[model samples]
Target chain A: MKTKFTRPERRLLAASCAVPITAALCTNAGAMHIMEGFLPQGHAIAWGAVCLPFVVWGLIAMRKIVAQHRKAVLLLAMMGAYAFVLSALKRPSVTGSSSHPTGTGLGAVLFGPAPMAVLGMIVLLFQAILLAHGGLTTLGANTFSMAIAGPFVSFGVYRLCRKLKVNRLVSVGIACALGDLFTYCITAAQLALAHPGEQGVLASMAEFLGVFALTQIPLAIVEGILSAIVLMMLESFAKPELREIGFLQKEVVKA
Target chain B: MSKKQVVTILILVLLCAAILIFPLMTIRDSEFGGADGQAEEVIAQIDPDYTPWAENILEPPGGETESLLFCLQTALGAIVIGFGFGYLVARKKYRAEEAV
Candidate 1:
């Protein structure tokens, strides 16, 4: 089964796998920080409103997918559980705000964004009830930002890189940056909505970019590096592991 | 992509761009986001002595459950419960379909 690949083919294969895998790992890096009541109330409510339709769509999609495979239900449920638990273990940051990784990106990359949304909603619900990291009223908002938007950004970045025929390392680096930054942008938007008396969208965006830049930019880069590293490791050592996680399939290679 | 799809994507992108630039579209830092009457009122009702008590306990010493452990346990429990329920429902449905 070991087909000898030419150098160009090897590079292409590596690029195809690394790009998406890098994004997936970056998503995983943020896996559980979706705390409730963190954003302004209005922001949370607004996002929640946005999330409702998505939830319905997501549930329909998931039911179809899960019916095809019962194990998918187990995986999604485990993912939600993972998010809830990781969120609860947050340490206090210098800003005096406790933060956790949402990890939605990671799960989304493994499964898909639609399933992740459903799973994320479940996690957010549990986080609110058990740990009080977020609130019941704000669950939809948190889910939209952390679950929906975050994964879209990660998945989008991966697909964009693939379309561009970008190099593996650089694609991963860029994808991670976008994935993390997308979450921050969503957070800023949510914050702006919930709180009143902001200067404007531009000003708030600037403020968020400015404040989060110092931390988020560096964090994004770090995540990118970690994701690249993980992809490389997966590529070289444990490719079968990637297959198990749905990163690769025998059919994709034949195509 | 189709012509209609192209238009849809353009509109969606433009809308997000608009929201990204405007903070007031989201609201501003007011009572909800600030230290104002709402916080005071909620605090007073929830725990009147919270201010002084917070000062004393801002940094608790020794022997506390880390947040990570707590999150893990919670997630594990949720997964077990959720899967258990989902499995039961799916199994029942599958059986019903078979019977029919």
Candidate 2:
């Protein structure tokens, strides 16, 4: 209700409708934010249903976090802000198109995927309302891919990497980059599933994956480096905050 | 920042810049469109009659407004992140001075 397209935007939306059957002929090369009214009603509702539980869990986790450490509120806001700033930028890709970074990885690594589900959802909601980039109808599907699935993957990878005794920064970097890639992968799978066409889901998935692979790989690397830099900055200036979230060891804290 | 941290961050910055710039240099006059539109096209191709059953509630009047909205989103996010970092740095300094 809060987000819709203007007439001119609808026309531009229609203008983009006249696209090549294959991705190669896409003249309006753009980022991967699913636009308004793109997903069918059933798919939209199903995705929304899938996201609801995660989002609810995120809110509960957020409450527990605040109860544990009041200062974590700032870190939480920072993570949400981090996600928005990164996601908003449409970086150029080798495919000669652009797509955004999910930006949820850092938060997932720091605070776990649950809170990020809430933060990422807020960012997606804002993008839908203000930018008309992603639509409300497809919000569930988009949120599931970017927020729920991606953050879970990021958090899991971060834990696994740390368990494997990889360097902290390197682990976080890998986790974040993989999270971004995973978001796009889920998006492709979701789209392919909803529109299997004549060739079926597997073939459609391959086609969708091909569309995103070249562009996303480089973007993922960029995301990893950027996330690592942010982690370093936080380490230098925000030790107490990091400690609050259990990201920094007790030895790292100033006496 | 320590020299090592500074150098590392600088190298990372350069790496990100190069990665983004490479695409622009190689692809002359490419539209660099969003992947979402391509997916939409694929959906349409797979099923020509699949009309989107829903519509966005609010669309910017034109392209300029859309750009403006996007800038606004980034600006808001940047401000919050900046404030968060600034607050943390100042708090550290305050604690140090208190100890002294």
Candidate 3:
């Protein structure tokens, strides 16, 4: 394979690879996104199986993206990195689940949901193995919530807002925020289903939902605004790239 | 620069302030737990006999250390991904301009 990487690119790659290896060597704590060994074997496997098709589809979609728009490969990789960084910046939440923005909202808005599945899964995998955050067993459940469900909702909501003629910034904000909230809701439901309390699955789900809402709601709003800001920055600085990606129509830019 | 941009920024700042303030006001005495920890507690309360089917392959020496490692890992990942993406996009632009 004739590969071309400049000196700076090689340096960047070297530094990036070194950081993870050093961090992995230093820590054993194994942080939690649903925690390690939190789920029963059966539930874990089931969720993993459920996620299989989406992942496969995402891989195919990613392949197509690379084939069709070679330039987008970088954007996709950046989106994955953005998600990892955003989600890892854990904030305290009332539900006791360390909360962070999923970053899928912005991704979905820019690249749509299917590709997000691939990007999200990659981010989760890195977090699991390198940082000891989120475990192998729970990868499926986490992937579903953060990657699949959240991005889909973001895409749906963004499109709906656009249809309703909402202001572009406002629509992006609402979509991203709602997307973050929905990720948590799905996560809570997953937990409730796995270990329903005396009140049954629905009641337990409600409990989880209520607890997460205390922190997640605010976090979602913040994420929404952040995503909107990011979008605006991209519009101003990366307008050609955005136009090429179909995120910003040429007519809209001209107008 | 634009009015809308200013409004967006203001909303973001206010929301951030609210997030910080609301927690302080309501949970002054409580130790806020992560969702994973709280979920475990809830499961135990709901079903006393419930046992985790698995355990972490490795346990860190301390919570703070674990957090440190996580931050480091994320920072590294961000740097790499950011650089790679930037390089690719810039390369594409350069190539296009050369052809033009």
Identify the candidate with maximal lDDT.
Answer: 2
TM-score of chain B of each: 0.32, 0.89, 0.62
DockQ numbers for every candidate?
0.06, 0.60, 0.32
Query: Model 3: per-residue lDDT, tens digit, A91-209?
Result: 76543345677888888888888778778877777767655567777887888888989998998998888878788878998999999999889888888888786789999888777
Worst 10 residues of 3 chain B by lDDT: B91-100
Query: Best candidate per DockQ, number?
Result: 2
Candidate 3 residue-wise lDDT, B40-91, digit = tens: 6777777677776665555556888788877875786589666865664465
Prediction 1: B-chain TM-score: 0.32
In model 2, how large is the Cα lDDT of residue A95?
Answer: 91
Cα TM-score per model: 0.54, 0.87, 0.79
The list of candidate 3 runs beyond 4 A from truth reads: A1-32, A93-98, A250-255, B1-18, B80-100
Candidate that scores best on TM-score: 2
**Candidate 2 segments exceeding 4 Å error:** A1-32, A250-255, B97-100
Candidate 1 per-residue lDDT over residues A108-192, each given as its tens digit: 5545566667777777665555544445655666677777887678767865775687765456556655665576566555544
By the TM-score metric, which is better: model 1 or model 2? 2
Calculate candidate 2's fnat. Answer: 0.74
